[model samples]
Target: MRFEIQFSGHENIRSNHQKTIEITKESHLTPQGDCIVGVNASASCADLPRELKDKLKNSDSKITFSISVENYEFIIKGNGHQDLILTHEEDIVIRKSDFICPRTLAVKCDKASDLLPREMVELLRNPNTKGVFSITID
Candidate 1:
């Protein structure tokens, strides 16, 4: 079976410095579906809930990740740093819909505020919609 891999956060998607990786595709044939791929801390830090870990752990391996995929955008706000918008050109960014709290900076997935872990819910809310784009990693 094949799977789609996506990472979203800073910008340099293809780089090794990514913070979070999400696998948007799921296998109905498998026990879990529609999950991200990576370690527990990574997923949790990425804002994926503990409840969803099983599915994410079982995801397919052929990842098609993007560093800040075109469909989504995000902002970074943390202590001692100016709030900024992360882009695809930076190695730290992941794919669309993923989150990353840089060591010195916190992040807000402009499009995915509602789905954030409850503790992070207060940091950011609601992403203003931008132009639409489409990508199918499967």
Candidate 2:
């Protein structure tokens, strides 16, 4: 199954955090939010589809998410867990660690914001740039 989130880029998108990748519902960005790749997000953790959230709570579920913008694409793979609450209201986060939080979408992710290509990070710095974060579960 699949779910997609639409979001826009921001000039302050640093994409330099070593452990996490994030998108937020806030329209504004600050350089200190180094993990946030997009803002004005279409969905927060609590806003995810019920079916998708259910699957994401299963320990056996495998999740893949593609962060696509313009001509660039970054893929992240992670496993779901029974511990996931998936109910944060303002943000969606992908973590390279096994941390579980309401804002986390996938844990043990293969990539964090710092791993994103510099070219892609540059594009993500444009406030007008649009992105699609699509997730598939199996």
Candidate 2 lDDT by residue in tens digits, 2-119: 8999999998999999999999999988789999999999999999989999999998999999999999999999889899989999999989999988898889888899999999
53-129 per-residue lDDT for model 1 (tens digits)? 22323323122222223333333221111332222121222333333333211222222222334222222111221
Output the TM-score of candidate 2.
Answer: 0.97
The regions of model 1 sitting more than 4 angstroms off are 1-46, 59-63, 69-138
Candidate 2: segments with Cα more than 4 A from true spot: none
92: Cα error in model 2, Å = 0.4
TM-score of each prediction: 0.19, 0.97
lDDT of 1: 0.24
